[model samples]
Target: MPCPACQAPSPCPQPHVGTAWKPSPDVTVERLSPGLPRRLPLRQILCLLPLALVVVVAVQHRSVLADGFGHLATAEWPWLLAAAAATCLTWVAAAVTRQGALVERLPRRRLLATQFAAGAANHLLPTGLGASAVNLRFMAVCGVPLARSSAALALYMLAESVARVGLLVALLIAFPDALRIGVLLPDGAAGPLLLAAGAVVCVALTVLLLVRRVRTVVFSFLRTALSEARSVHARPARALALWGGAITFPALQAAGLAAVGQALGLPVPPLHMAVAYLAATVAVALVPTPGGIGSVEAALIVALVAAGGPAAVATAVVLAYRIITVWLPLLPGALTLGALVRWKVI
Candidate 1:
């Protein structure tokens, strides 16, 4: 509308024009494709290539994959029960770790659900993104502030790593000759190297925790979250116990593999499976893929075979392990994730 002072048939204001209509800010739109060709669609297609490759492999190896179905039949009821017990222990240990890391109280049931859901998502999602996302969402839903939730996640992850490293070290030390046999490690001194690496990681983590400034920066964001977990009792004793559980989690998985080996009647010892299993697991974690998918399966098969298990047997064991540890939980996780969404918990 024209100003009254200079009005000569001024434009009429329509419906609270001046009162409610502040000038809209100018939004400049630049041509992002000025020089570069639009390649995102191509990139998206390429991104899916790996998944396609996995499907092809699965199809090609359908017979071998089908043979893996026999694993369920081979499952000795007694050992299966033991594996189940170990799995339960895994959750118990995780709850303890969460409690320790929170330095506050967390419901055991919730933590365990989070654990299972995270694992399940990790498996179902194309990349491990689904699982980590689930974990963050779960923590948020549990009333942990985002910052403290992050700290809790970091601590929990570290604890899990420590456990894995510990188990690896134990196996390496207990069976030095086996390490000397593996193709993955440097000749004659891998044991010391693995041990050294584990020690270094531990020391670095400890140092990070000890540095006040670093701690402040790393954990400041978690204050709101930790405060929410005020009921969580932070006891050093409990922390250690939780760490113990983290260690056992991997150990239980290893034991499961051993049980599979026995069920398959493979000649390789359980300790050998443990070492190979740990190595493959660590390797898979380093891969960029979600849940390590193709990489994990390949690594496990290679490691198990290199450790003297038959190729088909290794594949079978890995497949069975994934089925039990991954697929079994995925169905429930999807259901829970839906529930979480419906309830706006996420």
Candidate 2:
């Protein structure tokens, strides 16, 4: 074919400026002329929100991060490596728990990846909102209805909470003197904590009773959640996976902190460190800070000290543990989140 400008050559050196762009060979068109607009697909555009958030979080904690890294410098290497390994296992445990929450089996690889991304999101928002949102969206993409997905989420939370508290209770019973249970809860603090918990329960009950719509919604959601929970429990395999993962997730978390404590040469025994980790996390679970930031640090330090570690060393251990479990993987998790979002995996 000849170019419109100069029809003389075997090949046209200058193509018409206003001509339609060449279409991709992959696209099938009914008519060749002005082939379908070669626009980018929705999935092609990479989302930047996750990366931006990672930057903001990093910048906000620059000073604390610098100091945490400084503490890590003096820590033992082998134990730190163990802590990192334990941190990795937490994601696997979470993925298993997520699968056990529903009758449908999610794609294993994608589910695990979503859990990794959810961890990063968890740190960015308060009370697990970020992680819950990510998981809900992923389930929706996987064709799970919103109601069932919500039910699964509720089931997961319930199982996780039960397992965590149960484990804590067992540890306390097994080694009553080890953690100096008295020190973990200061003399006066127990009364206030109990009162606060009771008050919250009372307030929730009051709302449910007073508001008809609220009561109806609560009952409806509970029915769905309980039905799913019962179904999961009926299957031995699913029940095992659900309880095992729920138990493992928190146990691994404690193990990670214990490893960090050992690396820092904290005086507390490894078992005691694990105990402290659980107690501190359970105590601060309701704190509103993103990932329980401030509350976690304080509760952890006190708990570790109660377990017989020096206050300064306990502080160092908490800081270094957070660096490994929370800070270190944050960016990569965010990048993975961005990739998953770009690929429409979640």
If scored against the real structure, what TM-score would every candidate get?
A: 0.66, 0.86
Q: Considering every candidate listed, which one attains the maximal lDDT?
A: 2
Candidate 1 off by > 4 Å = 1-65, 74-77, 126-128, 180-182, 185-234
Write the residue-wise lDDT of candidate 1 on 11-58 in tens digits. 544443455433323522234336666555543453344345445544
lDDT of 2 by residue, 1-346 (tens): 4444555474777756787655456656655646567766565444577778778888988987988999999999999999999999999999999999999999999999999999998888886898999999999999999999999999899899999999988988887765777777667898888899899999999999999999999999999988888899989888888999999999999999989988988877788788888888988988888878678989999899888889889889998999999899988998988899988888
The C-alpha lDDT values of all candidates are 0.66, 0.88
What TM-score quantifies how close candidate 2 is to the native fold?
A: 0.86
For model 2, the stretches where C-alpha displacement exceeds 4 angstroms are: 1-46
Candidate 2 C-alpha error for residue 112, in Å: 0.4
lDDT of 2: 0.88
> Alpha carbon lDDT of residue 96, candidate 2?
98
